[model samples]
Target: MNGTLIFDGGCGFCTRSRNLLTRLDRHGRVGTVPFQEDGVEERTGLRPDQLAASVWWLDADGGRCGGAEAVNSALSAALGTRLPLLVYRLPGMGRLQEAVYRWVAANRYRFPGVTPWCQQHPAGCRPA
Candidate 1:
């Protein structure tokens, strides 16, 4: 596999993002797995708390990156371009991107799909 992305399955926003990633992955170079799945921790060598904290990308060469960096890596691979990765690595841009990602992740359940789903199925959704 070109790369593997691990994300929060219980998060609606994350799920929607994954769907978009799926569409962008025309060559199927990236694969996604919800962190909630069994064996994920063992496979990734990450603890449950760590997995739940951010989206993670595991590269083919045994490299791991999380949060906005993970997103950059996944997008770069899916679109078959280095633009996203390069942009993310720019001095201040990386910090800005990470801040935005954290903001979105913190308020994820306030979004459309998440709010409704969490309202109906509180136990199934992770806290925002």
Candidate 2:
């Protein structure tokens, strides 16, 4: 389960989530990448448009996941348990999760007190 987890670098919410993942992934099983970092697009083959649309998880097997599924994968791996079990079992959960992810992706900038940079370049903020 070695792969990179790519996230929106600029969003405050995203950064906080990354921090949580970092703490949980103390075993170094997961790698984190902020979409705004240099060469991220080239390394991951994910364009800015695509990165901005959803979070991405590139699995060790070369499989790619996006939106809530990606998030669930990352969380499950980091949690090392069945925390994401419900997401995997519920009927229609994948479609519903993707739809919710899309709505959030589209409206992320509207979050209160978001930085101007985040509003302008939602895909380019990389975690520090």
Candidate 3:
């Protein structure tokens, strides 16, 4: 994989979304890793708060992109398409996209599909 998709392991929405994206990603350009994985912070240069707030993408050379932009770029690369990336960059859309991402991320645990394990660690979970 050329990119590593760093996301929250404790989030139902994030895990489900990553799975959905993986299936959509026929090109298999990216690999998924939870923010809690060993050495993740060292590898991605991300603080815990930063990792908790958004999904992030790390390039082979260690270049990093976070939040909605990271999501769009990872999807685009994985599918070998530009339309998704283009849509994410449409004029006046960035703010709205980021807002939605933030909302979903903050409230991910409330959604269904959350594993029992993820729910067990309330303190480990992101802002509910």
Candidate 4:
């Protein structure tokens, strides 16, 4: 219960990214689930927007972090990476990175992970 890595399993890019992280994670620590799946919200107690807005990390202690911070956490937990954690803390990097992440989330359909149909009807595309 160290933490739970969450992603938009409905997104094509998110699915691919999860696959890559699973491969790179030598410790097998990159456990993830898409919030759109059944029972996920009840299980995680995360609000809907928390899942839709960005990738998230639900810490073992119940702390929540999303977007770039979540990425940093996943890497750190799964691969013990420290560089991104360090770089993100520099002066204005956090705010800038978060804004960029929001933009990417908003435009995810244009990326490789989503199809036009899925984007059009997100309700039907989640895991069964």
> What is the number of residue pairs that collide in model 2?
3
lDDT of each: 0.85, 0.75, 0.78, 0.75
Which pairs in model 4 have colliding backbones?
Answer: 12-113, 13-113
For model 3, the stretches where C-alpha displacement exceeds 4 angstroms are 114-128
Q: Worst lDDT window (10 residues) for model 4? A: 113-122
> Which candidate ranks first by TM-score, i.e. highest?
1
3 or 4, which is superior by TM-score? 3
lDDT of 1 by residue, 11-68 (tens): 7788778878989999999998878776888999999999988999999999999999
Superposed Cα deviation of residue 81, candidate 3 (Å): 0.8
For each candidate, give its TM-score against the true structure: 0.86, 0.76, 0.83, 0.80
Candidate 2 ranges with C-alpha deviation above 4 Å: 82-86, 112-128
Top candidate (lDDT): 1
The clash numbers for all candidates, in the given order, read 0, 3, 0, 2
Candidate 1 residues lying further than 4 Å off, grouped into runs, are 114-128
What order do candidates take by TM-score, descending?
1, 3, 4, 2
How many backbone overlaps does candidate 4 show? 2
What is candidate 2's CA lDDT for residue 87?
69
lDDT of 1 at 88: 98
- Expressed as tens digits, the lDDT of each residue in 1-128 for candidate 3 is 36889888877768778778889878778888878666777877889889878889887777888888888878877888777779988997877888888787778878876553245555544433
TM-score of model number 3: 0.83
Clashing pairs in 1: none
lDDT per residue as tens, model 4, 10-107: 67877777777777788766677777766777877778887887898887787778898888777777776667778888899989989998888898
